[model samples]
Target: MVSSAAQTPSSSVEQARQEGALQTALALNRLLNPFKIEVKVLGSTAHLRGEVENEVERQLAERVALATRGIETVQNDLKVNAELIEQPLERRAYAQRLEDATLASIIRARLLWSTHTQAASIEVDSREGVVTLRGQVSSAEAKELAGVLASSTEGVYLVNNLISLSAADMARLREEHQELIADPPLSDAWINDKVQTSFLYSRNLDGPNIKVATQDGVVRLSGEVVSSEQKTIAVEVARQIRGVRGVDADMLKVATKVSG
Candidate 1:
């Protein structure tokens, strides 16, 4: 009879390495060719590390990792390298491109949660403008909203959605999200809400000047935190909120006016 005990991680790790090199090779191909990035795959996780020309390349790397067979998740450590730009003007242009991508993602996320729309349940995470979506929605319509919102964002490089829904539902959700983007709402109260809450509750950060505002579910945290660790904690707090889809931490920084 087979034993009920769980296999040790070490044993599992060895098993994966011994299984075949095909998995590793395929992973490399996907990262280098289509995504144009270097990847290191071990067991079920893929580490995407290296410098990319812009945010788009950074996100493409993550998507390729997810598509590769047997990959459970991707650890994205891709950096945006302006130095890769051959010309000085090109480097500035690349920075602008990344900035646009980030801002777009923020706007889209805010629009998504601005109303009591059918997509109230989704969660969005935007980092340097790339959107990573997570959480459960009651229907496919909600899932599509998650994607559409991410896509519509100005600075968005890619949308990484981990939503669960039936095939039929997924189609409906996508359509709805698209419609909202095409005719976005004037006010984004929901997005502001998500941003505010993230800073207020994040354990990874603390600060005195911290001010949080949320519209719909996106949060904007502005203020002063003494240390980088505090800033991180503030962001984490926003992430924990249920309906939050995005967080803007630009306002968080070390206070210069205060005396030590």
Candidate 2:
């Protein structure tokens, strides 16, 4: 025997709770999160009000509301506006970040592979196509070479070379070089990575279009270049890498032009 007056307040509280739950569900949905949606609940029926990118999103919002624990029905009052949606800016930002990381890796590999800068310690950072080089090098020549290699990389727009000459670092590097000379030959994996990176750092070469594979101390190049000179440069770059016994470019070919 509950009084109607008492039942009114209890019913209102239940409606509010249901509305909150439904709104939370909509907000957490990937398709609906980007839109501003409003939810209202009356008894077991939930009403959605807002604009969505398309009919799919409208239906999705209604479906989400209906799936809530206390909602048995949905009143989808959402309007569709194709103009409400735009390309996600975060995706472009993520792509830029990935490019910067790859640029940094290529610069580091170039420094390590160069005979003049091989023993030098350097740090590379890239952002929006600008590269920054830091750490200590044995000579001004080494510092300048590091900058040149970074600036010459395909994706680099500018280089900030902050490498300083250090006598103590030079001594340490010389010792490390001697130890490296006593060690075994560079692994095939190392040679493969360096050769690919070198291509990226070298001008007039299409690094991404070229394929490189290493076995023992030999590198095999296979891919298309715009010209025969590019093909020759590809072979020379691979042969210059330390511990590379030979380069086989039999599969490398120059791209043929079609008449327009």
Candidate 3:
């Protein structure tokens, strides 16, 4: 029920993905300023039309689009106000650290504005080019999203996410974790069968030693592997399979028989 490459969008599958990409970009924007914008979707490409204050904001839009899972290319049609104040990158090499600090501030400001993040509790640090995020977040997804935001910021070269849940949140997380492990929705026997077959077909793995299970959309890989490398590969295979929302590899162990 899909069209060929040369065909029109007889189906809106690609269109939907493009729309999703646009929504992600808008969410990331947080609209700190009054600069109006428009988004257009063309196949796997994201077209951005807007006016921003400076080059940083201009590039921020492209970065957000590129970070989106479905967007392959971003066309930034953003106009920056020529009179706007911006850190002149053409300054001497000594100003490099200052630029990094500005990028960090931009990241922190965005985090504070995002509805999905707890920016006040999180500590942001930028040294040279790397940004380190510390403090507590509500969940694993929030932690990951924070890292994504930091890394996608214009000047960040590296990210160290040290955020964890608070004690109260941890308690709540445990209850959710228990339910998640106990039940998996949108998952069924077919996905389980596919996961097992994927391992069996993998040239690098021994599927017989790895047991695969699926619930809802979560995939669990248990049993044992001959080496740590094989264990990692097995987990990755399960993660790549369709219908898998999360992966549980807690029970997977590397065999003692294998030498380090």
How well does each candidate superpose onto the true structure, as a TM-score? 0.28, 0.52, 0.33
Q: For candidate 1, lDDT tens digit of each residue in 124-229? A: 5666556677765556555675565456443456878887756665566567666755764434564445545333322344433688776665677787887776
Q: After superposition, how far is residue 50 of candidate 2 from its true place, in Å?
A: 16
- What Cα-based lDDT does every candidate model obtain? 0.57, 0.82, 0.68
Q: Candidate 2, residue 149: CA error in Å? A: 3.4
Cα displacement (angstroms), candidate 3, residue 104, comes to 24
Worst 10 residues of 2 by lDDT: 87-96
Model 3, 119-215: lDDT tens digits are 3367888887688998776678778877766775555689999988887876665665466446544446867886786576455778888998888
Q: TM-score ranking from best to worst?
A: 2, 3, 1
* Candidate 1 local distance difference test against the native: 0.57
Clashes within 3 Å, all models in order: 42, 0, 4
* lDDT value, residue 242 of candidate 3: 45
Each prediction's Cα RMSD? 15.4, 14.6, 13.3
**Model 2 Cα shift for residue 234 (angstroms):** 2.0
Candidate 3 Cα errors over 4 Å, as ranges: 1-13, 30-35, 82-260
List the pairs of residues colliding in candidate 2.
none
